[model samples]
Target: MDTNQAGPAAEEALARQEQETITQAIAKELGISVKQVRTTVGLLDEGNTIPFIARYRKEMTGELDENVLRDIEERLSYLRNLGDRKKDVLRSIEEQGKLTQELQEQILKAVKLQEVEDLYRPFRQKRKTRASVAKEKGLEPLADWVMEQRRQGQPLEEAAKYIDAEKGVESAELALQGAMDIIAENIADDPTIRSWVRQYTASQGILVSEAKDAEQESVYENYYNYREPVHKMPPHRILAINRGERENVLKVGIEVTADKIHAFILRKLVKGPSPVKELLEAVTEDAYKRLIAPSVEREVRGEMTEKGETQAISIFSGNLRSLLLQPPVKGRNVLGVDPAYRTGCKLAVVDDTGKLLEVAVTYPTPPNNKKREAAAKFKELIAKYGIQLIVIGNGTGSRETEQFTAEVIAEIGDPGLAYLIVNEAGASVYSASKLAQEEFPDLDVAERSAASIARRVQDPLAELVKIDPKAIGVGQYQHDVSQKHLEESLKGVVESAVNHVGVDVNTASASLLSYVAGVNATIAKNIVKFREENGKFTTRKQLQKVPRLGAKSYEQCIGFLRIPGGDNTLDRTPIHPESYPVVDRLFRELGLDVASLGSKEVAEQLQAQDAAELAVKLDVGVPTLRDILESLQRPGRDPREELPLPIFRTDVLKIEDLVPGMEMQGTVRNVIDFGAFVDIGIKNDGLVHISQLSGSYVKHPMDVVSVGDNVTVWVLGVDLKKGRVSLTMRPPSGNDGGAK
Candidate 1:
């Protein structure tokens, strides 16, 4: 097995060579000058933001788009991690002082992380083992003699005869056995064998299953009858299988056919004479029993974990995007209803600012014969409160409640009062949580749920941020990922959303405050506490008095905190508190008060004029001054509101109702590697495969559509028995414009 041949210096040289080759490859693919690539790489190594670099250093990058810049950033991270691992391996090997010429050459020639680690394994620190004990007893010479016999076609017994008893070599048979054990251990530790096994398993293994020994019923029935190739298994299926395994409803195994691997390894390691052949066979058998099986299992598990994490991250990103984009139902008194069957529906009425004004209960669903009375009660509540919007929880009996609300609205004949089905995925989780109990001790759990639905309608971002991201149910496989990574990533998404759409400081909840950039839980609480003690913040400077809110935190967070009626006119704008002086300079240059600039009509007038003239007069960059002038012109504007509203249909069709060439209005539910799934009022979301996503060829589904986006789709095919609906984004006949 040539165990003593590969080492660290060789590996370092190989990695450096590979890195240069990859860099050249990337430069060629990106169609950029080599110098530009190098400069971008260097800047990326220094930890610069892509947006900052793209916007501010266009001369250096030659105006690289965000996609190319992000690609470079991700690739650079991988290469840097690889380089760090190489260095660690080299240091560990050098400390062992096993710097042989042959070993150095082999290590330097290795190309992958797995190969480098394999070469370093023999010298790597390990726990107490049989081989280490044999080496400690001074049996290395005898072991080496036996190994030589395997090469020379000598009998094992003859090779074992020269062993001395006192040094732990008691008999010829025992000596030969000890030597064979060492040989097996060394062969098993060989990097080549482990690498080969990993490749074979990844390419060919299947996750197969059988029923558990005990009878059990589970939600994951599909996995019990399923088998999928490891490389092709979808993320959701993997999560389902894992969840089933955790529940002990199935016994899962990663199946790798053994004969093929055995033959491959035998051909690689057993090419010498008869004794050597026998020893190689023994080692191969031992490798499978002692090393190969366990290693293959670990590798499969790790692959599954990686796949699961990627899927989970995708799901989280999609959910966060949807939550952030949820439409803000503004300027209306909203009545939220959490409907139930056994228990009556819990209702809460909140005004435009989302302060709870009333709470009640009613039976409006099945198992209740008082339907007419329930209708009367709903009309009385809406008329009494002058409610303009009805937010209903899309939980149990949601459709029936929707029908009930529609009937009541029909009788009132008021088209102004419309109903929206608010997603209540995490509302239940929040209602049962400690925070909910703390905030509304007098309210029952059902009432809390109603309040959440109402608050979401008032401002989706603010209320959705209160619940854990994973609990927000827009994901496909959230439970399969690392919880800590998922939490951090989703938190970033929430913070980005909150910062993107500036929050009203006086009206923001502590939960919403926590998502502001640079504001931790403690600072958020302190801000709320200060608000309670000192009334509304009259000026931005008053924030400094809040405990633990230092200058740095204030600088990062103040721009996003909107004070509706502050002393300084710029305090209500998105301009940072530190940038107040810049706004003052602009005001002085324009011969205008800050209040005069805070009107949309005035902002449009400023934008129509020459921005460069304003910049030169104010002594700032044209871009910076233009941005400031725009912000001042339309104070407290929400960026999200500029995007189009989500379209809902007056009528919905089921999967069974879908016919070929039928047009339907649907919202894209998920965009994946292969396709986009649209929820066209069907239990099973219809698939618009990548081939059908656009008229032009696209390498990825994201090129056309993203989650939460609404589009018109044609029903291309339907298999009702199979519960599958195939859809296409292409318009039917000669209609170039889409249907909605």
Candidate 2:
């Protein structure tokens, strides 16, 4: 064959091979057939979104789930990049006129991106370096001698005589040493060796430590004496070690056993023996010291840090999701107080819908001489607004503020009124944000914080969605992750929560509406604009008139929007607009109108009548229609209420008040790999270690409990100096009632 025709045929064969390899990798990762993976890749290459593929192309993909589809999308990007780099490498080697059958075959058969890059590195043009300088001289022949030690089986001194002394090869020993240096640099630059070392360190390396010279006593005493495998270390310990290294209290190093790694590398690059065996051994020793050791150490640390960061981000995402879905205490007028001692307390009152009614200051705590006057003003505001609840910010004087509210309610004697201590973790952060400034431009930062406290009590989900998820303070190691990854993961959590709860179309703010599954800022603003231009939506069909809303967007989001007084009964229910025809057919089959099937009892009566008969009449499946019927039975029900109501305490206790044998109620504040931290109204939270979680052995804290769980714990021990509280879920003495 001529060169041109042969070249095209060879290229076609190589491309086919690359495609087959990628298809196999994708099929293995997704647990699907190779044919299915090929079809999915073809669709993805044509610019289809994951949601679209998973929803519309079930037959082609064999019903791949969303997670599997996302994986395929990511793998496709990587494979395309590999192909682009391979073409560039072939062109560059051809330009240099060094292309050969053996080299081209090796490149084509390479499985990993790193292996391809390694084969192409020597052909790549670059700036001056130690190896380049040595090669520029007549020392290339000497370097080749060092590389051939295993094949030639020659002594190092005999190989050194071939180099010319005029080109800086002064003596036999000097030439051998210089040649060793060149070979060491080559092995260090090998991408395959670096990749292997990275994997090895990630799996088996340990982070060991010794104390620093300056600091004698530090918080990292345990880490200073500890040696943990890099992959097995928990996030908390990793963060602690990083913090210790930053403070110069410890000298950290990654310790890897050299024998295992050295043997592995030698097996790859060195065969039996030849004339140049002595020179190759010297080169290998030089490579270990000059190139491999430093590179491997750096790669190991980087991998450890990245792994810790990923695990921390996963934990933060879970906690933030739970904190956002906390149940709302809706439709009750609230009074919020930002308590203080040196400064007067800032108080704000909002009506049942969170409209600011009044704002004032009070001096009800220490250093205030007019406690009675403050008490009188509080009572007057409560009676005027008919306040049903009091929200106190859990800050400096939170307990004292709770006591003040309790005393006032007792004197007035209203049994229906109650007070709650709200978590104020991000109240200050929100108070200073641009959103807060726009909402309350004239109010002081303190007053805005007080307003947030009141709004949080009325609707925790809606108001909390306005603030950043990270600032809510439920995570254990949030600051250690990539900020972009953390933000995106937490946004997913908020989106899930908002869609699951079903927002109120008439009352939701733009911020809350933006979190709906398919809605962005522009769409949320359009919803609000439509609400303002035309009054409340009487029917969901009106949403179609809003700009930028299409069929797909409406299909995903309409079911989560609740209209209170719509034209049809299903408008108030979670049934999507597309599903409304099926529901109408259902009502027609029962000989009833939408108005007659309003209550759960009536809906159940209709459902008890034969779904298969209704499905035949309606031309729909029994499964979908049954789901629509259930949704119609309870329109706009809050799912958060199905969980336990949040626990609010009237008093705060100190660590000294707890005894070893006493049991107390506590709320879970954070969960880590080793244990859970519980807030039992004490200055120091108690730890429920993993071993004490249950009778059976547990591997992770998440296996037993999660954040916001309420449990009764028995105090096992308290170390006053260390400020550590140990707690157990096991019952004390003979009072066994199963684990809580």
Candidate 3:
């Protein structure tokens, strides 16, 4: 049968089989029913977004939340892609006339793309090599005879048969050498052997790294002489060693004994004692040293890197979500300060609504030495604008600026004036952006940064959306990972956060609205334009009139967008428009008007009604009814308010003031794999290592704290010269004067 004769019909049938295989695999891997997997896949295939399907298609998907739905969608795509790659591999091998039933079955059973590639490697065409050259010289027959490993007569005489001078096989020795080369290549290329070797080495190998120049000081000093088991090495250590190796500060490799690999290969391939056993033994050792070990080492390192990148991206995603969802310091006039030394501090005061009311500059540190004058000027501006909160950017000269602000507030004798230290990671990025330029054409970069600093405290989600997620310094080694993958994951995180906390359609900036369930950048801009041209959206129905926002887009996005004080009261809540009739019926049954939502009487009635009975009465799923009831309880409530608030300080603490056993309040600035970095009112943030995160075992530091958690940490140690602070969240022992 000609493999080329596989027609479209056959191809289509194969594709259908492949898709079914992928569906079954996903269902088992995700621990969900096959029906749920199939329905979710169909929804995704039909262009339904994760947020939309999670929120609206509860009846079809069994109420899978956003995270589960996203996991299923991601795994579905990966498995389908894996299946496609398998087909391509099969076709390529068949085209080469090397496809066997056993090989095909192995390829079909493979789950990972790496496994498929390993299976296809031997048949893959190669550049000019010793193996190819030997085969070209017609020595392959001898190699095959050697691979047979039968108790044959003398192998030298057998090699003599292939020794033809005309074909460049000048002597029996030359022919034997070429055959040995071919045999070694065959041993190295065997898929089964490679798989076992890879797995064994990964489990038993030790990753060793040593300093290239031990005397030189570098950030990788701790890793200069590091050795850890490959299977037990943590992701951060792997990434750090990789970075060190790439920077030429260290040499890294996986160390495994040749004896172990040798025994494994011989056990699998060697059948019995033969005349050519010694030759085969030498060939196997040569294959491992020259061909197999290097390849397997590369594979193991790549796997480690990929795993590290995945963990780093997950940490970044979680931290970004927590940071973006930090509760807004509502209804406070904030004065933002972009601190600097040679250049004066840039200040911008914004109203409770994030409207810029004032901008000023004062030299507070170094060369200028105008502390008194700066304090007097800031106090005057605070009095003039009635500033209730002062946000200082945690950047250059931040400590000095914070101290100055505290002194000025105390001098003014205004107990209402408090200060907070904002992360300000991407403020400069946002300030120099085109969006910032259009927003404040007249202000300089520093002034714009001050405005952003102020707006972040007022509304983090709205302001953070204007900057790229990558620029925000939340994750470790974000710049070293795959940018495309990182960006995709971060974008999903932003979307999840935005949809989780509904947006205000009337007042949301294009940046914020762009992250809604179905609204893209173009549509978000159009929505803002519509609002600017027409009036505020009075009802969710008005979204239909927005050009380019069609029915499908409205259905996907309307549930995530809120219109406070709109003509329809349901517009402000999370209840989908399709469920409005159900809510109306419930309202009538409860003898409450739609306008009386969130009223005391209505709240009482809702509390008294049985949710199960109410769900049946409304003819909606219990999930939808429960969500509606939650929305009614608090219309347009921000979920972030339920979490801890940012720590505010009326006085400043320098690094010199810290001592062992001193306890202080701080906010979690960043969470990483090894520990959490907390701001303890100093020049540098303190590290609460994973061991110190809790009294018991913790799988991850993020499980204990988040980016905005206000925790009480005791100072374990402080290095004033190095500007390092070590902290512990675990309460002190009773013997230590009951220190917190």
Candidate 4:
């Protein structure tokens, strides 16, 4: 037998053991079942996407939701990487011939990467320093003598024995200085001491900031003399302070009690009264002030920044999800308006399917003031296109354009005609892009923007996916946070939204298809190309025929790609193609034709049967069986249809029109940590502060409302000078008037 063959097997066994250890750790941290963690880890290791595992592998994961599964995936990756790093560190230490059993155990027991790094600090290679210089001078024996804490003689008297002029120790004092340097380095390198000081400083420190220019009236004025407890500070405030400091507007630092840290270190390093006790005490202070304090401060601030970025990314992700999942305004012929002043109000009339029918420009505000002419042109377009809804971009001159649109509607007396102010944040960016130019070569920037605005209301997901998610304006301090992390999180949000709602394979653009569970940019384009060449896909099986889309991609993606009128009605639903056998058996056992699905008779039959009992009969899990039954009931149903729709209006109101205690209906435009901006048919969206979000205490604005929520708010106050309008969701007192 070849002895080397066992080496590979041994390494594989070791890898498996490490993976099990990480899995067990994650299970304990998340307080989930070990079996669940193991199964999820196995599935993720098998290259199944999070959405696929969450939706399809319920039996393996014990029905963990997407959020939990994602958490598991992140933790698993982190722990596995940490374990690998630990192994590397251990190997390096062992190779140096300095590894001890105690140190090995400590490294193995470390929970965080920081903890492992701290343990490895002393062993880490360093550049030439004072300690290394002293060692180079052959003064290491003197340093060790000082560390021994001999009580029989004075340190300088003991140090004189090691003084050698040739070795650069000219005198006892010089030898003592080098010894103290070694002692300081030793104290600085103690992991236990460093860890304790870090914990103490973090718990007791205050983050203080002072304005660099106290007289300047900037947005950071509130932070001019800010001081907040490090432990209790909010993530937003930390990010704000960090930005303020980065911009040179404020000086920030962590303030901790120096005497307390010094005393603690002295008590740990000094065992008893000795000839070198005083020198050692001074070295302790020098180690902390010169070495430990600065490093610990950076670590604490870095930790805070990381935490703040995490929170900011989470907020952005949630907001993006809500914005992407807004309900589509189906079957509505709409006219889109890109509001402007000096130029003209650009218009694009799109049919219900977002197909542009006409484009024109009319001067409605400022330079021309062609109000009547614009109204006449709008009315003509409305009648010509049979336009049911008007979507106006809330940009420059939006208020005047909306007033003109309202007047046009009122004159026509078409109650069915309503206008909506769509947030056109990235419309211009999209319009000027290569994609937009390719999509519409003849249209100008404003014209393309108008079309995008119209299509946003028709189908928000489809239209918004064309623009970069970061430019969608659903986040706070998005640019200030980690761009890579933010992009990753936003992309994940879009992917989750796309997969959750599913996709119409025939109508979906490559931009939308690229975010599907298993699809990439290349595969998305290939799928669209295949569709264009081969015609509409009639069944999920046809996906495998697309070049570069293999069996794995088809299996991962086919379930989330829908065909409304396909050969298999199950294809129109979220049911996987692999489960057709179970469905066929179900239909045979029930004596029902698959074509009879969603019919009244089938609905009644499904409602009368117990899904759990049927699941056992069909040899499938209850969750899968329930999902199949739901799909059978409502084929090709859009999950977005269940969410609240965008608010529409036939009239416009200025900020001055708002009065205290007057109620009005509004649409949630953007939700942040502090409040929500609501568009209540006004030029400027009103602010619903976190405190005013509900009648009771509210933890976060998102907990009360999300983007696209149609809410009834009372006008609290309006500052027309600053163009600020404050609103509240809470009901007014008995004396206050209601909606006007």
Which model scores highest in lDDT? Answer: 3
TM-score for candidate 2, please give it: 0.85
Which model, 2 or 3, shows the larger TM-score? 3
- Write one digit per residue (lDDT tens) for candidate 3, span 685-711: 999999888887889998888988888
What is the C-alpha lDDT profile of model 4 across 1-740, one tens digit per residue? 12246798887887788778888888898999999999998888888898898888888899999989988988887887898799889988888888999999999999899999999988899899888888888778888887788777888887788788888889999988888888888888899988998898789999999999999888999999999989998888989999999999999999999999999898887779888888887888899999899999999999888988898888888989989999999999999999999889999999998888999999989889999899889989988989999999988988888888888889999888898888998999999998899888999999999999999999999999999999999888888898998988898899999999999999999999999988999999999999999999998888888988877778788899999888878989999977889889989989999888888889888777798899999999988888888778777889999876777788778777779998888888888888999888877789999988887778988788888888888998999899999998888763432112
How well is each residue in 1-740 modelled by candidate 1, as lDDT tens digits? 12235667766676666667557756886777767777788666665545445443455787776557866765666656665676677767777788677777677666566777788888888788777777776666766665554544464556466467787777766666666677767777878777888888888988887667444666766666678888888766677787778778888888888888878877866645656566667767876767777777777767787787777686567657766766676788989999888787889999998888889988988898467888888899899999888888878887778777777887888867777665688999999988899888999999999998998867888888889888987666677678887876677567667776877878787888888766879999999999998899988889889999987677667777888877877788777665577777876766676657656667777667677887777676666566676787677777777655555333334566778999877777666666888877655578998787777687766667766677888889999889999998877764542323
Q: Which stretches of candidate 3 lie over 4 Å from their true place?
A: 1-16, 164-166, 733-740
Question: Where does model 2 exceed 4 Å of error?
Answer: 1-27, 30-127, 150-174, 190-192, 214-217, 273-275, 365-373, 403-413, 550-552, 606-623, 719-724, 733-740
Give the range of the ten consecutive residues with the poorest summed lDDT in model 1. 644-653
How would the candidate models be sorted by TM-score, starting from the highest? 3, 4, 2, 1
Each prediction's TM-score versus the true structure: 0.80, 0.85, 0.96, 0.96
What would the TM-score be for candidate 1 when compared with the true structure? Answer: 0.80
> Of the candidates numbered 1 and 2, which has the greater lDDT value?
2
Off by over 4 Å in 1: 1-120, 124-130, 133-139, 146-153, 162-174, 204-229, 244-275, 584-593, 598-601, 608-626, 647-662, 668-703, 714-728, 734-740
Across residues 440-489, which tens digit of lDDT does each residue of candidate 2 receive? 89899999999999998677889888898889877766776678878876
Model 3 poorest ten-residue lDDT run: 731-740
